[model samples]
Target chain A: MRPRLFTPGPTQIPERVRVAMSNPMMHHRGSEFKEILAGVIDDLHYFFQTEGDVFVLTSSGTGAMEACVVNLLSRDEKVLTVSGGKFGERWGELCVAYGANTHIHNVPWGDAVNPDDIKKFLRENSDTRAVFITHSETSTGVASDVETIAGIVHNNSDALLVVDSITSAGVLPFKMDEWGIDVAVTGSQKGLMAPPGLSVVAMSQRAWERVGSSNMPKFYFDFKKEKVALAKTATAWTPGITLLMGLRESLSMIRAEGLENMWANYARLAHATRQGALALGLELFAHSPSDSLTAIKVPESIDGIKFVNRMREKYGITVAGGQAQLKGRIFRIAHMGYYDALDMVAMASAVELTLRDFNWNFEPGAGVRAVQRIFMEDE
Target chain B: MRPRLFTPGPTQIPERVRVAMSNPMMHHRGSEFKEILAGVIDDLHYFFQTEGDVFVLTSSGTGAMEACVVNLLSRDEKVLTVSGGKFGERWGELCVAYGANTHIHNVPWGDAVNPDDIKKFLRENSDTRAVFITHSETSTGVASDVETIAGIVHNNSDALLVVDSITSAGVLPFKMDEWGIDVAVTGSQKGLMAPPGLSVVAMSQRAWERVGSSNMPKFYFDFKKEKVALAKTATAWTPGITLLMGLRESLSMIRAEGLENMWANYARLAHATRQGALALGLELFAHSPSDSLTAIKVPESIDGIKFVNRMREKYGITVAGGQAQLKGRIFRIAHMGYYDALDMVAMASAVELTLRDFNWNFEPGAGVRAVQRIFMEDE
Candidate 1:
């Protein structure tokens, strides 16, 4: 049997989506493809809850983040970056790479940034061009309160509120237009339930205004160029046709479920998974956890590496371990896209068996029972 | 029935490769993924026929072309760009975007650059950092003499011979090591017989030497960072997992056929296709033609768009019309990767029927019979 994926991003793709990828590729410039483009674009805007223009890129999510920097900010431009975890830190790294004088607000890992810190920074730096925030910090399973932060930025100054919603766009409740976010970036592989390849970015009229004044060297990821092509239901370069076809199918699945119900389901899965882990005497890592995934602190006596390996090799279930500083201390089990209560229970059961085999201080079926009870009560 | 693609890229993905894409995506950092990455990288080296490192990028071929520019050249560095087609022109655009002072040598739209002109240009520009060339210009169906050009550039100056072999790598005879090319860039959808998503680039030691000194501003496409990750059998960012699995299957098919036999097969098919088109009183557009695909001048009486549309709508075969300035003047039919003699004959028959249906000048079955005769002669 194939191992099930429980990583934060690159989660398990639904069979329907994978089957859509099997459709034979066609010319990107053909009318048939343009029709697909028009439908997919409309569906993306509906999913993003934004009336603004969203552009598809043949790149990873980081490329979209880089596009946000190069297309909206100039050299030595002042931007405030919120770095709570790895994805958040990437915003700062890209800013530095582009020669932006960025002020990074460092929130400790495993914690969400307080909205007030952003307000205070905006007050001190009224000339900031943008406020870069990660909606979901996958490394720590913490989602920042982007709604409040967007409000704070828009109220304080003319700074654009740019959010990296790669892991949160479809899994969480994010309304770009209602929340007044100027730019929202994401990828196809995460909550969108498609294979990796295409990155998506939606920009408000306010952000487009900044693009006209911005002078950053870019060719492949020029947002203005992509926007022009999208206007004609075309792409500036060859589109990632196969991934886009899969995305249309995945978006159809998302729309059928309705975004609100999907978000609610993720919340239940996270709750059940966390409840199962806690029932086995494991501690939760994040104070303000995200529904996309749940992070748990490993018991001191158990090797986190060996524990994850056992879950994979012994039971054919894959979970992600903590990165960088928390490598040996925390492990993350995601129930993001294409996952349900039974998938969560299977992971929990594997965890229970692996920990029991290691002689950890836990009941053998404690986690599995907790997961099952949570699902039954929810039903 | 779905339309068959004969465009330069986003070509028809084979059934086995499509089946491979159906495998559930695994985590990028998992043990299973690392194993896959190691194997893919090894096979890519063999396919490229180079001892140097090849990096798997999750973007299109243009992204890999941009990587060669940003990673190997700093601001205001002198580089000679040979532009004949759209993809070839992209190298200059990227260099100019990155502040490189490029001297573009324009080869007329359908012809290849002469080796002597490059030799003379290198003599004039002794301080040139790189010589950008295209192995197969898909837009014009012109295959540049990259092997000869690489020799001229190496013998004259310290310039790195960068070749955009997007359509030629798998369809034609290309030896990265033997030809002394410094950088070779390609996409998966063309001759590799996989879906669009992953772009492959191999860099020689000579090009890596310049990377350390290059000061181009880049983050997502930093080649040095990708190399470090590849050393550990990993990627710097999340990879296109499903596409890579599909690529492994495609590469196995390519190797089983043997690169030399594959190249010969493409040559024969191209000859048959050109012979078929010529038999219909069609004029070949490119003087120096490519085996990957063929370009032919459209009849003055026929509408290029309608002609292509008729082939697709009536016969379920898709051919490409010209881009930019040549939109109504020419059409392209590809015989690259996974196409056999019968496939070529089917396309030729469609062209004959579509042209006849449009009441343009063509004899019935002349094109099909010519293609059959060529294939039989080869046998």
Candidate 2:
């Protein structure tokens, strides 16, 4: 049997997205492709809720994060990176490589960043140019307070609010212009409901102003050059044409349901999952949980690594385990994009069955009952 | 009608490869994915004809070219770049961006670099760290004599011979071991008969020796990180899983046909294409033509841009025009991977009809007859 994906990113791609990508190759410079590019960019704006420059870069999500660092900050510039999880730590590494004086606001694992900590760091380093944060920390299943943090940054120093919303966009709520976010980055394989390969960046006019004076030595990820070609309905380099086509279909689906409706759907799924895990005697790992995914501690008697493997090997259902320090302690279940109510029911059943087979002390179907009750309440 | 692709990369994908990619997504960190990765790497070794390491990077072909520069050469190192076409110019750009003092041995566009110029430049600059060249310059339909240049580079100095064989890997004859080439990069969308997301780099033992002492700051495109992951059948990043799966099928197809037969097929198709263009009173642009593609100057009276559009709009065939300086002066027809003898015949007929529509003076049926005769001779 083909294993179903329950990891945060690379969730099960929708059938429509797969069929759309199966079409023949396209010439990126031709009118057909230009028309496709224009429509996709428009939908990206609609989904992002921003009328700013969004360049579809052909790379992994990490590439977009690198672009934000290299294009918005020069050498020895003061920047604050909020390091709570693995993805947040990436910002500090990228900034350090580009010769930035980086200050890391460390948060404990399985916890979101405190807005006051960022404020404290900024007050001490008054000349910080950019404040980097991850919207949804994939490693810990925690969603930071981006809106509250954005307001704090805007009210204080003139630091640009940069976000890595890779696992959050299209799954939860993100308002770029309304929230005053300067720059936000995402990847295709995450909540975008498309395959991996394309990274996207949407920058506000304020961010563009900072980019004008940036003197970083970059070629492939140059936002200025990509923005110019995007104005001409082209990309600066040869794009992942098939993935772009898949993204077009995926975006249309999001638009059809509306972004708010999509967020509501994810909220319902995540709530049911947490309730089910709690009913089955599992502990929730994150204090501020994200609708994107849920990190749960293994039952006291069962081994976390063995439980994760049994779910994959016997049941053909794949979930993600912890990384770095959390390894062998917790596992993650994603209710991100392209998942529906029945997917929730099926996953709940799988968890219940896996625990039962492992001889754990839990009521059979308790997890599935929670999922059914929550789904019924929503319906 | 759907247009058949005749442009150099992003060639027509086979249905088998498409179906393979359309399968459900696999978890990148799972055992199933590890199995796929192991088989793919073994086949990559078979295709690259190298006993050294091969890293499958998830980006456009330019990503691999950039990897070579940022990983091998340190800041302020002397390097010689042979600039003959658009891709060749990219080597100098990347080297300069990475703080290398690059010297360009300029070969005019539409021409290939002579090996003697490289020898003269190397004799003058004994401390050159690397000699960058292109195996097939896609923009100009030219192929430099990499074997000859590699001999000269190794004989004169300890400079590594790096090549961008984006359009020539499976389409043209390449002998990495026999030729003493240190590094050669190619993309999946061209001769590999896959999509445009993955880049494959073959590194020699000699190149790894140089890499140990290099101190260029990189993270995503880090060759050492990628090489370490590749040893265990993995990539450092979340790769394009669909494209990698598609590549497995595509590489199997290439192996079934044998690399020598594939090269012969491309040569035959390219020979017929050039003769057909000559029959249409078109001037062949490249002096040292690559078997991957054929560049033809437009007839004196017909506009090149309009002719290219007519082929796309009226004939359901897609070809590429020149890049950079020669944009409206020439059009390119690719006979790379997944093209058959009939594809050449159909493309030749379209060129003939399109020219006749524009009232250009050309003998009727001459191009088609040339294709038929050449195909028959090869058969």
Candidate 3:
């Protein structure tokens, strides 16, 4: 049986994208690859809704996130980071590794930090040169208030706003210029419906200027050199050519669907999932959930890992377990990338079955009924 | 028409390997991916013939090369680098970016640096902590004397030997422990018969100890964290699952052919290419050529770029031109990955047609006849 991917990343790839990846290998320095790379850049700019430099790297989203910190700030530079989930804490860790003076705005798990808190931290720490935030916290399925946070960062000082949009770029609304985000990074697998090799980093002019002055140790991820090479529609080294071909196909699919419509679709699926979970008497983990994925707190009697494993082993439905302190307490079901109403229903049914097997009392048809109700109500 | 890829990297992926990349997406943290990752690591160790730790990263070979330098050397540490070809020069560039004191053994392009020269340099500069060299210089199709260089470094001082095996790993003879190579870096695309996203870095215990004390900024490519995570057969960050799948398939093919036999095959093909080029009245660029690729100097009257472009446009074949100062003087034909006698015949035929188009005044069947003669003579 083909297992459908409900996991946050390595999400289900479309047939067309997989077929695209199987195309014959091409020389990376050739005219054909250049055309493909240039097309990907243009499509990414359109998707990001920014005229800023959008570059692709042959690594996961974390590499792009690291590039953001490494390129933007010098050693011992002040940075304010928000840690509300696993990914949020990753920013602080990277900053510390880079020898940056970091001020962490720690928040409770499964909750978004308030924009006012960020403003207060920045105002008090006048020496801070940047603020790092996660647009979608995959661990808790919470989306940050990026628009408000960016505005606050700009008004407070000259601190640049960097966002890890790995899970939110195509699933939700992310306007780099309009939202005043100085830097945003995303991966290819999540909402892009491609494999997990390519990463995109979009940077504003201000961020590039900062990169120019920063003296950090970097070569492969050197944004300045990469930009220079990419200007001629090439990478500083051999790129993931197959992944780029898959991305070209995926971007076409995204364009065919339209960005606004894709966002709307995710919103609809997230609402249906939340309604379905509630109908099954399961509480949501995040106060403000992201459209990308939904984290549901497992009952104290039921182990979250076991729940996830059962879904995989029994129903061939893969989901994600909690990280860090939330371990064995929550599981996440992603609604991004190649998902539709049918997938939502299937996931709801799988969840209902898994809960029943775990001896949790829930109505047999409650989850499916709730999703259908949401769909009907939307109409 | 499907184009044949003869470039050094982004080489021709085997049909089975391409099929493997079409494997359904899996959660990186799941048991399935972990199983696959563990298998890949074990196979890598078997192929590399080392008991040292082998770490996989989601970037090109350059990322692995940088990882070796940044993770093992502290700022201002002295390193002796050999600059013979494009990749050899990369070591110095990485050292400069990381604030290291670099001493160069600058050899001209298309030539190998003598190990005695490195020993002399290390004797003069006793403060050098490491000596970096490229095993196979893809830019010039030259293979260096890494074993002798390693012996000299070990005998003279405590300087470690680092070899960039990006283009040589699976196609050539590289016994890490036997040769006393402290660090070896390779990519997936060149001789591994896979795509270009994955990089492998194998480090000895001594190098690991160095990594422990070195203080450099790293997160995504952090070997310490990656090794820890890989103990449980998982990656520190999301991996390129599809590419890993392709690599697994490629390694299986390597195992089927056996490492030593595969190396012999590469050497045989390289000899045939050299004989064919000579029969076509072309000059070989490198004094000591590598089995991974063959470089031929075009006549002064014929433009190298024009020859390469015409081969692609007319014969649907792709080859590489020289880099830097050597551009328009030499063209490279890669015989790495999934190639056999038939492929060689086709490549020779294309080269013959291409040279004729440039009015090189060569006999129509000269190149093909030369390759056939090599085959018959071997029989």
Candidate 4:
């Protein structure tokens, strides 16, 4: 059997998107590609829910994060970074790497960052140039309250509110213009329902002013050059043509489903998965779980590494093992993109089967029953 | 009819490679992907003809160029750049953007840079840190003698030899280790027979020593982090997973054809294309033409812009128009990846028909006859 993907970022691609990409290659500078790009740009405005500028870059999500840092602030500038998981810590690392004077607000793993702490950091360090936040930390399956943090930063300091919404943008209720976010970035994977190549970034008017004066030396990630090319319905460099073709279909799928309905579907899937895990007497790993994925703590009697390996080797289900400090302690089941309630039930059933082999105390059909109940009640 | 891609890049992807990418998505951290990455890394050494470190980065070829500059030299360091066309000019621009003390050696648009002039530049400025050269200037279809320049830099100064082999690596005879190149970079779209997302870089032992002490602040393009991850058959960041799958098949196709045969095929195609254009009494653009593409100067009586438009509208063909200074004066027909001699015949036939539409003095079938003769002779 073909292995199923239940990971957070590199989710399953829909059939139409795959077929669209499988068609013949087209030149980037051709009129056909320009029309496709213009349509993508229009669709991106709906994706980001912003009246500001939105750009597509041909890199992974981490490159988008670096573009945000290099474009918004100069060297030696003060910034506040919130760290609660692996992805959150990357913001601080990026700041340090680019010679920014970063003040990291550390939060406990499996817990979300507090908005009050961000306000306190801005108050203490009155000259912060930017504030970095991870809307959905994929490593811990925790979602921070970005809207509250954006409010706190906006009311307190002149710092630009930059967000890494790689796993949150299309899966959750994110309104870039409504939240007054300066910069928000996401990848083609995860909530975008495409493959992992292109990354999209939306900038507010406030962010564009800072980008013009930022002294960071950049070329590939230069926002101004990209903006100039975007005016002509082109990209600064030759983009990933096949991936963008896939994205055009994925974005169309999202639009047809309606962004609001897609977010609601993800919420339902997350709810069912969480209930199924709880029904098996498994403990959750995150204090505030993201709708994107759910992290479950491994039982003490079970070998976490072996449990994960068996899920892949025997069941042909590819779920994500915990990263960094939480390695072998937890496993994440994603409900992010191109997944539905039936998929959640299959995942819950796989967990039940895997647990029986580990000699864990769990009823055979209990987890799957709980997932079905959640969907049945909603219907 | 489906539109044929005769543009330099993004080139025509092989059907097998596209089928490979259309398979179901797999997790990047899974064992299956790790095996794929390991195989790709092994095959890349054969692709670049290097025993030194080879890395695949998820960005455009321009990003690979920027990676070489940022990882090898610090700010305010002296460097020499040779510019003969648009792609060549980019090397100098990258150096200046990163605050390097850049000295650009400008050659005429259609001519290759003189190797002796590079010797003079290094001798006059003995403190040069790196010498940058474009192996194939794509805009003008000019090919520089990289082997001769590599020797000049190695024998003359302590400068590192960095080459932008984006259009030349798999199409031409570029032996990274054999030529003593310090750094060489190429993109997937041209010679690799893959889509346009991933770029590969090969670095010598001498370049690694400089990378250790280079103080340019970088995160996404960090070669150290990539090198460490590569040792484990992984990437520092989440890569373009689908593109990498496509690359595996493309590299396999390259290996099956044998690298030497692929180079000879490109040379034959370039020769046939040049002879075909010359048979119609057309002038060639470059003094030293690259084997990857052929640029033909448009006759003054024909409207260049309309000639290009009619080639696309009347017939389903997409060839690249000249860029920058050569724009509207010349047109380029690429004989790069996934193209055979029949594709060359079709391209030449299209050019003949387009010229006839503009009432130019050219006999029908002369160009096609020359192309057919070349292929028949080879058989």
Candidate 5:
């Protein structure tokens, strides 16, 4: 059986998109590729909801995050990073790595950062250069209030609001320009329904001004060089050509299905996944969950690792177990990209079967029934 | 008609590899992907010909080049960079970007750096932390004597010999361990017969020691994190999953054909290309040409850009024009990865057609005849 991917990132790709990428490889610098790149950039503006330019990079989401850190802030500059989960903590770590005077505002795991806390921090430290936060923390399946935080940062201080929107951008209704976000970064493998290796960065005009004055050392991920090349419909260096080709198709698919519809679809899937887990007598992990993935607390009676492994090894359903401190305590069911109501139903069925194998207290069809009810009601 | 890729990078993908990647996208963190990663790493050892650890980075060749610099040298550390072409000049540019005290030894555009010069430079600058050079200068089509330079660095100084083997690794007969090289970085698109987006690095024991002590800032391209993750047959971050899948097939093809056989095939193709260009009354561009690609000086009568454009526009063949200072003065036909003698013949025929279009004086069928003769005689 073909494996079903329920992991947060590296989500399943649609067959149409896969077929599009199988066409003969083309020269990245040629006119044909430039046209495709231009189209991809246009569609990216739609998804990002930004009037400013978006740069496509050749590395993972972390690379884009690093690019933003280097481009916006100089060493010894003070920045505030919200640390709620693994991804949120990465922002703080990146700031630390660059020798930025960083203040990490740690939120409880499985909980979203409070917007008021950010306002208070910014008010207390008026000299903050930027604020780094994650829109959707994939590790804990939490979605922070980025819209509110953007307003807080804008009102409270002159700090630029940078958002790690890797798991949120297209999956959520994010308006980069309307919300006044300075920098937003995302990866292709998540909401774009494409392969990994390409990361897109949408920088506001405000962010671009800081890029020139920033004293951070950079070469491969230099934003100004990328900007110059983008103006000419080219890249500063050799891009991830195949991934860009695939992204052209994936972004087309996203456009065909309006961004609002895609966001609503993920929301329905997230709701169904949460209801399904609850029907299986599993507790939901996140206080404010992201629509991209649903994390469920592993019961004391069951072994989380074996449950995740059996779902993959036996049923060809790959779900991710929790990472870092949450290891062996939770399993995540991702609903981002190329997923439908039926896929969620299938995921629910797989969970039901696995729960039975682990001798947990759950009805045979309870999880699937709950998931079907949610989908049926939505329709 | 299907367009043919003759540019140095974003090379044509093999049918088998494309088909392999077209399969359902697998979860990168799953056991299935781990197995694929293990197999890929194993085959990488064969191609790199190294007992030391090799890293697979998810960016273009330039990213791996930056990784080596950041990992090996701290700020203000002394380094010598050999600049012969656009790519060779990039080594010095990256060093300068990272605040390294770099002395770039400028060689004439088409000429390779002399090994004796490197020996003398190392003797004069005994405190040099690293020596950077390019094995194959893609822009100028020149190949430096890295083997001889390796001996010079080993005998003369305690400096690490870093080589950009992006175009040379699989196309040329290179033995990393036997040659006693310190750090060699290559890309997947050129010599590995794969689509772009991935780069590989082979670091010797001596290079690894410098990585930890070096105080340069790094996060996404951290060699230590990648090395630790590689021991478990995984990447430190999300890798280019689809590209890696394609590379697994490409590497298998390389192994089945044998590394030495692959090198010989590229050599034969390069030889045929060179002879064909000479038969067209075109002068060779490089003094010490790399087998990966052949650079020919564009006749003053023909517009180099127009010639390259016509080859792609009418004949569906894409060859590269010269970069930087040689722009509009030279054209390059690449023989690297996934090219055969017949492909070289086709390239020659396309060159003849375009040369005729430009009204250049060259005998009809002479170029084709020369390429055919080389192939026929080699057989």
Candidate 6:
């Protein structure tokens, strides 16, 4: 049996999105392909709720994150980064690679960064050129308060507020304009409900000016060149046309469902998942959680890797193990993309079965029942 | 009617390959996905005819190109580049983007770079770290003499030889080991018969050593991180699982046909296309034309854009127009990926009809007869 994907990324792609990718290849530079691409950009802008310039790059979300750095900051420029999980540390590492002066506001592994800490750092370091943070830290399943942080950044200095929204853009509330997010990046595989390989980056006019003044060297991820080419409905190089086609289909689905409705659906699923985990006697890892996914702390007796493997081998269900330092301690259950109530219940049932196999004390059928109760209550 | 794609990149995808991508999404970090990824790497090694490390990146071929420069060269490192066409110039541009001191071995457009010039330059500048050239320059349809240049680079200095086989990998004769290519990059959409969004890069041990010492910044395209994760058939970031499924099918077709047979087929198609174009009184652009694509220079009386537009409007055929400065002067017809003798004849017939619409002096059945004669002779 084919495994159902409940991983944080490479999420469950709908049959329609998969079918859309099967369309015969088209010339990326041709007018027909451009028409499809322009449609995607328009839909993405609507989803992002920003009139700012949005561009799609043929890469994972990390590529777009790197673009945020290479385009907005020059060598030796000061950047303030918030480190709370695996993805949060990525900002500091990227800055180090680019020879930038990085100041990290680090938190515990499963905790979200406080906006007050960001304000303090900005006050202490007036030379900070940018503040990089993860809107939703997938590794910890925690969502940072981007709106509060963005407001603080604007009030303090002219530093651009950059957010990695890879796992949250579609599943949660991410209003680029309303949140005052200068630059936001996302990938196709997560909340966008498509496969990987395509990334979207939306930038405000203020962010565009910063990109122009930044002296960092880049070519493939050059936002300015990409923007100019995109204005003509083309790209500087051959794009991943098949992935773009998939993205167009996925975005159409998102628009049809309506962004607000989609976010609400995710929130409902996440609440059900949390309730189900509690019913199984498992604990949530995050103090503040994101609706996209949930990080569950494995019981002391239960091996996380073994549990993940058992789910895959026996039940043909695929979920994500804890990343980096959290390995074998926690596991993540994704509730984004093409996921629904049935998916949540199925995952909850699997967790219940796997916990019993591991000899962890959990009531049989309790988790699924709890999820059903939550769904009914919400209805 | 389904439109025929004859563009240089994003070439025609086979029905079987398209069907392969329709498989349901798989979790990238799962064992099942790893099995598929390992199979692709093994097949790629076989196709490349090298035991060197091969990496699959989720981007266009240009991203692989950037990976090559960023992973191999440090700031202010001197490199030699050959610019004969649009893609060749890309090497120089990327090198500049990475702050590499670049020396250009300039060749006029539509002509192959002279190996002797490269050898002389390397001898004069011993600090030149690498030599970059394109095996097949898609814009001009010129296939450079990489074998000779590789031999010259090895004989002259310790410089690495990097070749862009984006448009030539499967169709052209390229033995990475025998040809002394340290780094070679190709895309999936061309001769691989897969859709766009997947790029393959093969590296020698010497190149890997350079990557270790190079300090240029990278994350999503990080070769070292990818190499470690790919050992277990996983990517550092979310991969394009759907595209990988498509590539698996395409590779199966390649193996069944045999690489030698595939190369011979491309050569035959190239010969028939050139003969057909010549019969229609069209000039071939490249002095050393690639087997993958045939570039036909339009007559002064006929607008190349109009000729291309009419072919698409009338016959639903999409061809590639000239690049940058060469726009409206030439058009390219690709015979790569899922194309056969019948497809070639159809394209030739469409070109014949479109040219006739422009009042060109040509016999009614000239192009088709020439192509048929070539096929009959081959039989």
Q: Better model by lDDT, 2 or 4?
A: 4
lDDT of 3 by residue, A116-143 (tens): 9988888888888999999999999999
- What ranges in model 1 sit over 4 Å off? none
lDDT by residue (A264-331, candidate 2, tens digit) is: 99999999999999999889999999999999998767888999999988888899989888888889
List the pairs of residues colliding in candidate 6: none
- Taking the tens digit of each residue's C-alpha lDDT, what string does model 6 give over A1-379? 5578898887888899889888888888777788999999999899788999999998888888888899999989999999999899999998887878998889998888888998988998999999999989999999988888989999998789999999999988989999799999999899898888889999999999998888887888999899899889987778888888888898999999999999999999999999999998889999999999999998888778898899888888888899889998998999988989988999998888788888888779999999989889986
Compute DockQ for each candidate against the true complex.
Answer: 0.79, 0.73, 0.87, 0.89, 0.88, 0.83
- Residue B64 shift from truth in candidate 4, angstroms: 0.3
Task: Name the weakest run of 10 consecutive residues (lDDT summed) in model 6 chain A.
Answer: A1-10
Each candidate: RMSD: 1.3, 1.1, 1.1, 0.9, 0.9, 1.2
lDDT of 1 at A266: 92
Ranking by DockQ: 4, 5, 3, 6, 1, 2
Best candidate, DockQ-wise?
4
Q: Relative to the unseen true structure, what is the C-alpha lDDT of residue B156 in candidate 2, on a scale of 0 to 100?
A: 99
Write down the worst ten-residue block by lDDT for model 6 chain B: B26-35
Model 5 lDDT tens row, A258-357: 9999999999999998998988888999999999999999898888898899988888899899999999999998899899999999999989888888
Name the better of 3 and 6 by lDDT: 3
The segments of candidate 4 whose C-alpha lies over 4 angstroms from its true place after superposition are: none
Off by over 4 Å in 5: none
Between the candidate structures 2 and 5, which one is better when assessed by DockQ?
A: 5
TM-score of chain B of each: 0.98, 0.99, 0.98, 0.99, 0.99, 0.99
| Tens-place lDDT digits, model 4, residues A1-379 | 5588899979988989888888889999888999889888899899889999999999999999999999999999999999999999999999999999999989999999889999888899899999999999999999999999889999999999999999999999999999889999999998989999899999999999999899988999999999999999999999999989999999888988889998999999999999999999999999999999999999989889899999988898989888989999999998888998889998998999999999999888999999999999987
Assess every candidate by TM-score. 0.98, 0.99, 0.99, 0.99, 0.99, 0.98
Question: Candidate 3 on B93-190: residue-level lDDT in tens?
Answer: 99888888888789989899988999888888888899899999999999998888889999988988999999999888989988899999999998
- Per-residue CA lDDT of candidate 1, range A28-71, in tens? 88888898889899999988999999899988899999999999
